[model samples]
Target: MRLALPTAVLVTALTACSAAPPAAVTPVQATPSSTPSVTASAMPRASAGAGEGLPAKLRFTQIAQFDKPVAFAVRKGDDAVYIAEQGGRLHAVKGARTTMIVDLSAEVSKGNEQGLLGVAFHPSGKWLYLDWTDAEGTTHVTEWAFDGTTAKQRRDVLTQDQPYANHNGGQLAFGPDGYLYIGLGDGGGGGDPQGNGQKLTTWLGKILRIDPRGEPYVVPEDNPFKDTRGARPEIWAYGLRNPWRFSFDKETGDLWIGDVGQDSWEEVDHEPRGRGGRNYGWNAFEGDRPFDQGVEAEAAVEPVITYQLGEGGSCSVIAGYVYRGTKIPGLRGHFLYGDFCAGWIRAAPVDDPARTVEVGKVEQLSSFGQGNDSELYALSLQGPVYRVDAP
Candidate 1:
């Protein structure tokens, strides 16, 4: 869904409560389009202690593993988890069983930060979308039909040329408006060598929203540049460096973006849904500070929150969702995010003035997944998917 304007910020001070125990796991049908049937009440909040602010009593159990899993999405009514591996394979996990759903090794361009990079499922669960780099080093977004057992009817919907292999931001998701949003990085090489971030003619360095349900994927009529001259009508937001990942809050529809920085800072941008046409200062500014004097004053946008590279014990921030899951009441309304390099997990309650609190920590956290129930899952780069539960 598109976001409205930023609203008033809300702050609350939370104290420690006991960790509520976990409930028994009830088996549910493993279908491709149905939501998972796991129902557990929120765990009691545990005391907030030292060491990165995660509750001292929190722990995680490995439920499943994936090989080089880069992105994942869950069906709205299905217990199954769909994972995208960097090696060009899509895998499905359901009730203790995992299987390959699609293989694209021949079409994938695998390397340093390249390959199958993102995946999303249609709200209807009948369609799945994938973003990846092709053998020619360009990025392509494709859609596939999914039956209960396998993926068929592959169709390439969007393709963009790439200058380098590294910064091909291949993340895809369907917004609340039912449009597929694709994130692309500045044409690779260090320092925006191709100058794509500041250029509006190319699809690179921008967030694009398209109606993939149509042939050739039509651009939404209201896209910011639909009537502008020499601009890609599909562009939603521009001037992004490498927006590795982005997500919309299920409740508020706010877009949380994690854009990788050049040499100094990594940023997290919060764009209220529906607020397009804003330039997320990239080559002009890095994380609210001027990076290039010439472009800094050119009406550039700013990130709602940002962190320096080494501060707060984090490296690359993995943008995540605000908790709406019933499994953890205290975690409700909290935005749970992690550091890909530091393997640290932290939660900041949305709009909470206490913006620096760390709610929990997961070891070797590579990515976060959302289930059909809206519960969050933490995936370790090595393997194992842990349901983000309370203590």
Candidate 2:
């Protein structure tokens, strides 16, 4: 569920809607954004802070290994770590004691990027929210009350129809403003076939925000497009292709996204706290390049860092948190990231963009999780989650 599409990739996913689907492609047409302009921002190098990105070499000690683990969640003030497997189960790990909080295999779809993709605590850690694709390939967000003994009170929060099986960018996290943010792919087909990224009326290809505690869901009062005509009230940001992983800086509250490219590049986008409604050109512009010569919107934001890879070098970018942990004296304030194909870990300053420093590596790096105290861990696709440690 996390990758690129060839320029000529064929469609092979199930299309199950009664009426015409959003991304249904027969005769592809172009929908121009509100403003048609293009700007390719160059990566700028900045000076590093004192003792920042200074660890000569880092170590990744194996903490535990799980069955194809994909997502991770840690409760505030708790030592236990929750690991979600693509096989549909949540494992709670505290020291040597491991227990199953819930099993969702009966509910989630398997293979080709479908499974338990994300989990978030209700700020207070009293409620657990899970985002997964059901067996039929539709995205579902559910909630459960947690008290450490049993995960109770199952509640279905939201659902979205997926036209294709791939490109489900399922990453769930609560924003600094307290709204639940859900990242969804553009209904799956290659090259924004559905036009969901720019079409505000649909939930696909966009970032959605809702209050899960409400009857169905509550859109925040100041959500950017809440009152715009022909727009879905829950849409916060639009025009992203497979935002595989994203995180909010623990200290700055800014949003950082690792948007997998169409075929040539990978990017990391940043948004200042409270800044929503921004368009991140997808098919129109792919990571600082005019993908199809389509004019991009003037307001369309550019990525903070954009890098191209050779045929088999490194492609998909997996974004991680800015190290605000105290344990690693040198990594503080540096944003860490990796590639699914290339397991090497790298970091760059939040205030600075271009210059990057190599950190460490973990094979099949899928996602990174932060402990309650801000310590970081890398989840690998090939078993073995690693704890980021130095000295």
Candidate 3:
């Protein structure tokens, strides 16, 4: 729910304690990223050598549906795919049957961009994590003991007080190094009035890395700002407005982010494996243009791709994964992403991100999930979860 609106509309909605709802979306133009190129031999079989052309046809197959599914996760050695509903219930989908495995209806905050927004499992599959907004609108990243059949013994690993309801970046994932990574938005309000994006003292507008199994949590020494004075030691990257969704390449371990833009642009940022300490300029720069000339950012990383807002109704970028599954050979090496309002899913080759082709669409697209097999699934806020596959 990263939809933008006029100041008058925003104030009215906020006064009612509501977030900006979805609006019509349109097509947008993509700008190529500045990352290095990969050799043709490294590309998947069906795809023409690096940056050459589009891949074969692909389609979405309805695997199952749920009540406003926002995140999908899997447990190691388990055959079921777990979907986290915004209303605070975890559903386990095995073949055609769906079962409620964990319920937190009484615990979650209800509204746009809130609720059980993210779900992930420990690499060992012994722990389940939920990134959710509590009844008071504070974000609580909780850990639960799990035995595949049920989840119990919940404990809070991290908590942050949200300033505004909108722009709560609620996505979680385990990096290739096994550290839990969390995304949080700039304390909401248009134009970053709080100045959190470029501030190091707060966790807002940043990505954090920590070991959650510790008492509460442990900030890894390797984190970029761990020893920096006046900075939150957990921060791995900074200067983001609202990084709603991000993912790591399963094969290359490279990081990709879809940072929802402020007003004019939507962007996708890329960081090579282990390349921390990046400043994805926000409040200071939107897309490639300067937004706030007063704020200074040190060596900001430019977006690999950017699209204009309000063009063909395009709004709210949903960052996805680089396909590495055996089922979609043609999609291998291509990064998949979409817009929440536009509902169109497109894939751009890792080499040339500007040359994108529409792959599929999911109504009310909320997030994308990668399975244990490296396959992908797209979740819709409208209740359908589709598996990416060759038609």
Cα RMSDs, all models: 10.9, 10.6, 7.3
Those runs of model 2 whose alpha carbons end farther than 4 Å from true positions after fitting are 5-42, 45-53, 295-298
**TM-score of each prediction:** 0.83, 0.87, 0.87
Candidate 3: give the clashing pairs. 25-312, 25-313, 26-312, 26-313, 26-314, 27-312, 33-304
Whose lDDT is higher: candidate 1's or candidate 3's? 3
lDDT of 3 by residue, 1-391 (tens): 3342112232322234322222212222222222212111111233434434444445666677666778989889999889888779888888757788888889898766678888899989999999989888898899999998888999999999998877778889999999999999897888888999999999999999999999999999899899999999999999898888899999899999989887788888888999999999988998878999999988988887787875546667889999899886778899998877667777888766765767666656788999889999887776667787775
Error of 3 at 54 (Å): 3.9
Cα TM-score of candidate 2? 0.87
lDDT of 2 by residue, 160-247 (tens): 9889887888899998878799989877766777777777889988888888889877888898988899899999888888887889
Candidate 1 stretches with Cα past 4 Å from truth are 1-58
**Tens-digit lDDT string for candidate 1 (1-391):** 1000000000000011121221122332211111111111111222343124334333455566666566878876777888777678887877767778888978887555667888998878888889988888888898889875778999999888887667778778888898888999887777676678878898888999888888878888999999999998999988888887888889988788878776566677777889987788878877666776666424677675566664544556677777787877667776776666555566665664125345555544556778878888776555456676666
lDDT at position 70, candidate 1 = 69
